[model samples]
Target: MTDPKISAFYVAVQEVNSLIQNGGTSSSRSLEEKIVEHLENAQLLGKLPKMGGAQEEVFMEVTKHGLRISAARSRLVKLRIPLIELVLLTTFVDGFGKTHAVFVEKSTTTRYQLHLLQLADDMAANVLCSLVKNAFVEAEEASALIEVIEPPSPSIA
Candidate 1:
């Protein structure tokens, strides 16, 4: 299932591009095309610790605060990748032509997580990415709306 407001991705693989720092490589091709190219060669990794299932059903929603990932059936949020924590967002296309929404998250100063989410189509991929990007911009604007000020000190005695 997919929606403009949210996207449901079958998490085909996590940590697929863990070794890469910037969330896959740069490409001059269209976003979807770049994904397809990487899909052929992206590293195959084992299941993440505590994350079972060949394909994990997760729902992703971009909010004012961050990007939310939740269990589809349970509706329990697994993780929220804050705007400040997101490294980069990229997408890929599987051989079947499904869209894979890839995002790198900075879990800690020393740890990063790469997620390969398989979306139903290209439109969902576009919507999700746009929302995430917009959220980041909005958050930055909100933070910069006001600046701290200090009153001048009284004249020295």
Candidate 2:
């Protein structure tokens, strides 16, 4: 039997994809807002971290050598290394200054990991921030559809 939580999460993801495909208006609720609302309705948000707390910013300095992941403070152990059985949601800049968001899920007791989501734009950074704040509960359900939507590239100023 399929897990109800997983089913609900996929439904929410499809809804977000529909909104994006239809070219939702500025007055309409955004994909992030819709995702949060669906997750809330499904009672999955409680399993995740609460938003609006004091966040420890970990700056990923873009360099020619490639971006290295590091924690800004010792208290944030999750940022220090690639963790297992945990969700990683972070944003970084490429050498060209374009921002990208990545989501990874690591398996416990193994070196296996899944790169579930990646988006190249600032709006994705905002979405990634939301996902991180919520501890990425049910984020795996959205993984399949994430690649299908191509958000417009960030315009260089």
Candidate 3:
């Protein structure tokens, strides 16, 4: 017997990978778009917890440096994406720029941790914000660029 939740999660991850491989932006109806669509059809979005408050509102946060996804707990579970992996991904996104998207996938059951990245040009960012607003239907904390600071070197004996 197959675990249905795991299967669905894998599908989402696969969709994300496909979208990134193709020339699709967060604004484009690419992998993230398709995965979200599937969630909607399955009625998974609302079934999950909202991000901030009672009045729902959803949007993607794209600072000049990074991309963040909110309102995606029930539809998809969060998994650890190590810092090294994120760096590699960001590099790829920079290379792709507006012409392509970058994504990562991992599966423990069927699919576990999956993420997508796109070099957000101003226009793409704006469009993505709008689409996320419509689909997410919930407000969330602003996404900030994660700066990994190393601990200061310990004094030698």
* lDDT on C-alpha atoms for all candidate structures: 0.66, 0.36, 0.33
Winner by lDDT: 1
Tens-place lDDT digits, model 1, residues 1-157? 1334455555644442435444355644553344345555543332222222357678888888788889888889877888888877887565545567777777777776666777767888888878887888877787777444455789998
Q: On residues 1-157, what C-alpha lDDT tens digit does candidate 2 reach at each position?
A: 1211100000111122333344366657754444434434443435322222243334432222222233445423222222223343445543335453443333333332322122345775675465344433334445657977899999999
* lDDT by residue (tens digit), candidate 3, 1-157: 1111111011123333443344355565654445444334433445422222242122234332233334434433234433223312211212113222223443332333333333235455345444434322322222222234455899999
Name the weakest run of 10 consecutive residues (lDDT summed) in model 1. Answer: 43-52
Q: lDDT ranking from best to worst?
A: 1, 2, 3
TM-score of 1: 0.69
Q: Between which residue pairs do clashes occur in model 1? A: 35-92
Error of 3 at 87 (Å): 14
Clashing pairs in 3: 56-137, 57-137, 57-138, 57-139, 58-138
Best by TM-score: 1
The TM-score ranking, best first, is 1, 2, 3
lDDT of 2: 0.36
